[model samples]
Target: MQKIMLTGATGLLGRTLYKTLVKDFEVVGTGFNRATPPLYQLDLGNQQAVIDFLEQHQPDALIHAAAERKPDVCENEPEQTIALNVAASEFLAKQCAQRDIALIFISTDYVFDGKTPPYLESAQANPLNLYGQSKQRAEQAVLAHSTRHSIIRVPVLYGDVSELAESAVSVIATQISATQTTAHDNWAVRYPTHVEDIAFTLRDLLKRPENLGGIFHISDNQAMSKYDMACIMADILGYPQSLLEPLDEPSQSAARPHDCALADSRLKQLGIAHGREFKEALKSILLTA
Candidate 1:
């Protein structure tokens, strides 16, 4: 079995992938703040720690799912964001290159400035926020430093949360479940891709690492505003739709893209199709959760 090491093991994507891929491969997952069985604590920002971990584990592949994702946090802590997102990414890519191990870097749709409708893998990155800039830099590092690497770009993600209000969808579900009225931002459009599908896609990508290398977009091919998502959530949970209200997009310190929907034509050509529609995926998650 291929020995695989995954970063951000305690994160939504990392934990999901670990649960799905553990039976198929020898998986070692790592997290910073939280450490559990099969997952050890490591500071990715510390080059020595990362190098030592990689040398010790000697995994055949590494899936980099760790990042400073919050826009406000990234904006406030630009240096820290660079430490984890760019420097750590470059170091990991270099180590993987020397070890001849396959590397998969998880990226984001925020790299685009939301000027275009449906972004492809080849689209030029024009990030609006520090978070997006950090991820885009990490993508470039993977491309420059790694010999065998794949960059997977994803959009707004939702899944079973370990904590309350982990994702926007979960927050919506929580708010609507308790209160009769809830307000949602109607401006920015998003593609609510499920974490399970991304995990499944990574599993499939592992089967053909060579073919899947380079940049690829994998998102549920549906575009809906946040208000629309709230409506769907309300409907799914049997909550009153009348309680949902559209509110203007709140002013933010960080600039976010208006629309970051992705099209995976390349993934389809490679026989890797996204699993389900947004609503169906959301329904499945709600039922299972």
Candidate 2:
């Protein structure tokens, strides 16, 4: 079995990926605080710690899922964001390169300014926030340091209870369940992807390391606004749509990209299978809960 090293194994995506990977490979998962199978407490920002960990484990592949995901938080701590997102990633990529291990970097759709619709892989990135900028810088560092690297850019993700409030759809679902009203009448547009699909896609990519290298956009095919997504969730949950209310976008504090939809044509063309529609994915998650 291939030995895999995964960072951020405690995170939403990281946890899901870890659970799935352990089923098929020899997986060593790492987190800053939490402990799980093959879990380590090493800080990636600590160069010596990272190097020592790599030297000790020496996994065949490295999947980096760790990052300060909150845009506002990143804005508040730019230095910390850069250290984890860019500097640490560079160190990992270099180490992986030296060992001829495949490096997989999880990136975000926020790298785009959301000026255009259905962003393609070839489009130029113009991040509007510190988080996006840091991720973009990290991607650049990974690419520059390692030729055998795959950068998978994911949009909004939802799955499992852990990702609920963190996910736009889950947040709306919980709000509608509580207040019986739509909270996001007017917010922003994005393509929501299921975490399971992301994990499966990563697994497949690892199997075909050569074909999956470089940047790839992974997201559901359909795009919808926050208001529409909320209404759909209410409908799926058998809640009355009257409870849904739309809010104006200008009323929000954080500057969100209005149309951050990603195009998954490349994924399809490459024969990468994706799972359920946004509504179906949300329904399955609620049922499993």
Candidate 3:
């Protein structure tokens, strides 16, 4: 079996990716501040520490899953955001290039301006916020470093969460549970994909290394805004929908795209896809949470 080194193993998406990838690959999981047993501690922001870890494991491929995904937080702390999201990525790409290790960098659909719908893999990136800008810069760095490197862009994701507030998707339930009067942004659209589907898609993609280069978009087709998600959660939790309000205009500290529907053109050609109905899946996750 091929060895794969995964970063951010203790995180939301990282945890799922680790569980999925380990079934077929010799997976080496790594984490930072929350590092625990079975998860090697390594700080991506520290270049030398990262270098040493890479040298120690020397996996066949590495998945850069650790990132600052919060737009508001990234806006508040640009230096910290860029250090982990951009600088660390560039450094990792360089190191991977030197070691001849295949790299799969997890990215976000926010790389686009959201003015355009259904962005293709070849689409030009014009980010609207610091978070998107950092990921976009990191994408450029990774691709520029080597042709063997791959970028997988996904949209809002939700899956088995440790807490209601852990995932942006599941956080709707937390908000609705706290107060039926919670307000949500109705302007910006999102596609809440299950993280397990992304993990499965990646697992399948790993079987064909020849198809692992350039950019690929992985997302569920169902589109809904925060308000839509909250309303659904309210219904799921038996809360009154009347109290939930929708803000028609931008309601976030950082500007977001209106709709960034990713066109899974590359993944489509490779005959690889995984998706599930929004409401049905949400019901199971919410019931468990």
TM-score of each: 0.93, 0.91, 0.98
Over the stretch 1-289, how does candidate 3's per-residue lDDT look in tens digits?
A: 8899999888989999999999999999999989797889998988889888888889888999999999999999999999999999999999999999989999999999998798999999999999999999999999998899999999999999999788999988877754537788999999999999999998998878888889999999999999999888888878989989899999788999999999999888888989999999999999987
Which candidate number maximizes TM-score? 3
State the TM-score for model 2.
0.91
The TM-score obtained by model 1 is 0.93
For model 3, state the Cα shift of residue 182 in Å: 2.2
Predicted candidate 3, C-alpha RMSD: 1.1
Task: Count residue pairs with overlapping backbones in model 1.
Answer: 0
Off by over 4 Å in 1: 177-180, 248-250, 287-289
Model 2 score (lDDT): 0.82
Please report, as a residue range, the 10-residue window in candidate 2 with the lowest summed lDDT: 178-187
Residue 137 lDDT (model 3): 98
lDDT of 2 by residue, 60-144 (tens): 8999999888887887888888888888888888888988888999999999989887788888888988888889998998888
Worst 10 residues of 1 by lDDT: 170-179
Task: Report the candidate with higher TM-score, 1 versus 3.
Answer: 3
lDDT of each: 0.85, 0.82, 0.92
Q: Please state the error at residue 178 of candidate 2 in Å.
A: 5.3
Which candidate comes out best when scored by lDDT? 3
Every model's Cα RMSD, please? Answer: 1.8, 2.1, 1.1
Off by over 4 Å in 2: 177-182, 185-187
Predictions ranked by TM-score, top down?
3, 1, 2
